[model samples]
Target: MLRNMLTRDELIQWMRTELPRLLQEDPAFRAQVIGILSEALVSKGELTRLLDELRAMREESQRRFEAADRRFEAIVEELRAMRADFERRFEEVDRRFEAADRRFEAIVEEMRAMRADFERRFEEVDRRFEAVDRRFEAADRRFEAIVEELRTLRSDFEQWVRFSQQEFAALRVRVAEMGIGLGSLGLRMGQGLEEVIRQVIESFSGAGPLKAARLVLIDEAGELYQPGARVEIDALVTDGRRFLVEVKNYAKTDEVWAFHRKARFAEAKLGETFEKVLIAPAATASAVALAKQLGIICYTFRAAESRETSE
Candidate 1:
């Protein structure tokens, strides 16, 4: 009985290989196999029900599988669209990057050109500066030479100025000495005239020669010859009357006025009448007029010169 039982694959293999031979050659074995199979298999009603359930399960599984297949195809189509869009965007980005690279290369080339031009200009400027420096150096040398020449001229001019100053000093000293000599000669001539006047007074008035000459006069304070204490008198002679005389190389109005004042003062102090006389080699017209106005006598050496020449 255990051997008679057949597995599902053994039953299917026997049906495929031996069922035809069994139906023709062994009708009784066929009936026996049918009975064994009938016992091993389910009842017809149960088999029908099982087949219906299997059919329904197959239809459901088929519907589910088709729906899954359709969903997978839709997903695949959407992924393909997304990939195409990404590829197109990537291509556009690549084109933009290429354009940017070209623009950067142009800018870099322009910068290089500008730098080259700047270098050339700088070199030209340097050459110009060098030329200007040379000119300045030449001007400086010329200015220094001019300064040196001016210094030499200044030295020569200073020497000339010093020599001129020395000459002027010597000329001034000579003029001063000549003035002193003329003053001394005038004094000596005045003294000689005083002696002559004394002789004339003794011969004309019969007053004997004066005993002593009055070199100075006195007042209550001191000697009257204060302003000209060092100076000698021109003439001083007395014949019981006072006489005042003044001599000069050249007499002007000022000398005549001075003589008048001295004569007036002497008369007031000595209580005697005084005779005033002025003598000079030449008298200015103003001195002669002033002498006549003041009642003083003026004697000029020019008259004596005329007389000597005439004789």
Candidate 2:
């Protein structure tokens, strides 16, 4: 019988398994066990009081849980409202961004059109500038050509002017020689040189330093023209100034000597100093030399003209 009896752990295990089943399915057995436990742990009035306190605590816990649920539902509603507002604000921001993008696109399109037009106009202006540059280059070449022409003309003109000056100088010299030739020709024509000399002496008196008080022709009445005077001297005495004069086409050294002798003889007769003058178209260099040696001033047309005739 002892071997067939349960051990302490087996009895505990059986109670742990069967006690909840007995309480759930055996009403009479559950009541008997509850009565035994209640009587052993607490009296009837104490147990009744514990049950009442437990029921009040359960009802208070239930009310607090229901209030917590109500507060959680209100927080959920507030979160839903915040989410909706955020979504609406994000939509509004998207619409503003879309509008800004459209405006930017329109501005870009306008800028593209303006850039195209500017490029076209700039190309036209560049072409015009190129044309103007070409024209300026052509004009510069023309001006260069004109300047070269002017330089050539200036050189030619300078040469022509030099030639003209030389020709004119030669012509003037030829004309002077022809004038002297004409005078000789008049002499050859036998045109009375005495009358010509008379006119010359009268005109010389008008312009000479000594005006004529009277013209006494030594050839006519003076002792210089007496018979065998050895020289036919054409002489004039004016204002007591005696001048022995003669004219010839060409004078020689002997002719100049004869005139000097005539001057000496006239001085002897008139008792006055006489100036000797010989006028000729040309004379030998020897005749000019002798006249200078004899203190006779001679006037002639030759290279020695400068030495005798400064006036």
lDDT, candidate 1, 1-311, per-residue tens: 63379888888887889778877799898889889989999989999999999999999999999999999899999999989999999999999999999999999999899999999999999999999999999999999999999999999999999999999877754553344335447456653344544543454446665532433344444334564343334566765665666667667777677677666666766687766766565767767778889987776533222211112
RMSD, every candidate, angstroms: 24.0, 19.7
Error of 1 at 188 (Å): 6.2
Residue 189 shift from truth in candidate 2, angstroms: 57
Q: How accurate is candidate 2 locally (lDDT)?
A: 0.71
Note the clash tally of each candidate: 0, 0
- Tell me, by lDDT, which candidate is best: 2
Clashing pairs in 1: none
How well is each residue in 114-232 modelled by candidate 2, as lDDT tens digits?
99999999999999999999999999999999999999999999999999999987775455445444544665685433444434444445534433221232444444556543444
Task: List residue ranges in candidate 2 displaced over 4 A.
Answer: 1-4, 7-54, 132-311
Residue 75 in model 1: shift from native, Å?
99
